[model samples]
Target: MKKKLTGKTALVTGSSRGVGRLVAIALADLGCSTIFCHGRSEASCRETARQIESRGAKAVILPAELSDPAQVESLADRVLAAGGVDILYNNAAVMHPWRDSPEELSFEDWAWSFQVNVFALVMLTVRLLAPMKLKKWGRIINLTSGIDKTPQLAAYGASKWAVDKWTDDLAAALAGSGVIVSRLDPGWLKTDLGGPNADHEPEAVLPGALVPCLLPDDAPGGSFFRAQELRNFSLD
Candidate 1:
């Protein structure tokens, strides 16, 4: 695609570390000047901003607990004030109480998953939809997983499945609106949540993770992509 996002603003959550961080840097490298390098820390955000700026891209820092509706609203507001969010990377997620069987997983686990995975997404999407819709162009990507079929990580899988369905529904609801909705599975990267021994590295999938966001506005939406399966679109 073109350097279409050069002047656009992109916000990436949990971008202070790992895959989210890599995506932020990658988008900057692709000539997107304004990127919101978001995390839970002022210090980390500054550090992320420094790195992006070193690459000659502008970075904004907006921090919030992804699960909190009010915080998500505030984040959207900050992005709007910064000239609206053109791309949204919902890359942050929770993998709580590992190894707890479905029945053994506490109500708290369920609540927390929905809070971060589902509710916060709805809130943020709701807030940004108007701006994106008006601009007649935007990209929204939700990071999901392939293990929704696996026995392990039952709760995490279930939550991502929710995200998958939600993304598809949103795409259908807004067909022809120019706002694209898609889901990305970053191929089980080795992060704090993915564990140290995981099969993939965060950097390995950075380019593919950026693709869904960079898809042309006329391209199809509501599809699922694993980084390994997205080589067809790689600019490299």
Candidate 2:
């Protein structure tokens, strides 16, 4: 049987591990033609590339420190040069160290979070939008957090909030344009950022995580999907 994304290409940021890694592999399993795995270093993405190749999909390792704007631009340049992608999964994010109080969060913390979580995401999305628009088909999934009332991680939460806002606004702008932009909250999984005590395992993000990518072109943009809620869900 043929797969869902047989002719499609994708880019999953932070795909070296955790939720990004799982999502990239799942896309490959769905028959994506090429999946770009982004990491801070090429070495970090080797395993993911191997896994994707094993599934008969080509994996390209694109390394860039998202915290740096120049690196983000370089990453985008590389992707565009490679002919862009049919799907863009903004899954990588950084969490600030928990502070005793919200007021204790430093300027650096907020800046760092915004740079990687918000600015970098926006830059990539904007740069890639043209290609998707030209083709009149695309999927943009921005991973967000359900974090709330936890002032200890204010910087992280605020950055994710910005992501939510960006998604909503972009969705509006891209409405009826054939390119759907939406948000996906992977829940608190036991990943590096989620810590060992997280409620769910990283694998729990599978099928549900791919929902946004598989949506019909007419599906509304800006929809929010929760991976945990879609557990045991069927894609067929």
Candidate 3:
């Protein structure tokens, strides 16, 4: 039988490592024909690209610094030029160092966190939305977090809150438009961002990470998915 996403194209940001890299490879294995692996530099995504190809999918490396608005726009422009993607996985994010006191967190740290985690993600989403609407089919998965009450990581937590709000609003607007936008929490994993103290391995993000992408066309938008909750779930 043909795979669910056969012939579909997808873009997985921050895919050079960690959760994004694993998700990108999973998408390829599920039959996404063209997988755009994005990272901070082309070299960073080479291994990801190789893995995608090994899974029988073509990989295109697109590099951009999410902290820079110009680079974000350029990244979106390039993807649009190549004919927009069918699935968009906004998986890139940044976290500020934990400050013993929340008051000690610098404004610059908060600014940088929001710039990469929220602003850049929204910029890419809106820019690529038109094509999806026109085609009447698209899946957008925005990565969010479950961090709470940890003032030490307030900057990161606040940024994720902003992502949740934006995702909710966008989903409402796209209702009945055939473009689905949802937020996904990959849970605490032992990735660079998740740190070594996290509860699960990065590999545990699979199956659950791919859940939103495989939702039915009639599936409602603005839903929250937790990868850990679906840890033992099967796509088949």
Off by over 4 Å in 3: none
User: Could you tell me how far off, in angstroms, the CA of residue 229 lies in candidate 1 after the best superposition?
Assistant: 1.9
lDDT of 2 by residue, 72-133 (tens): 99999999999999999999999999999988999999999999999999999999999999
Off by over 4 Å in 1: 1-4, 149-152, 231-233
Pairs in steric clash, model 2: none
**Across residues 119-232, which tens digit of lDDT does each residue of candidate 3 receive?**
999999999998899999999999999999999999999999999999999999999999999999999999999999999999999889999999899999999999999988
Candidate 2 achieves a global lDDT of 0.95
Question: What are the lDDT scores of the predictions, listed in order?
Answer: 0.82, 0.95, 0.95
- What digit string (tens of lDDT, one per residue) describes model 1 on residues 120-158? 877788788888999999899999987755545676778
* TM-score of each model, paired residue for residue: 0.93, 0.99, 0.98
State in Å the error of residue 62, model 3: 0.4
Q: Per lDDT, what order, best first?
A: 2, 3, 1
Full ranking by TM-score: 2, 3, 1
As for lDDT, the candidate ahead, 1 or 3, is: 3
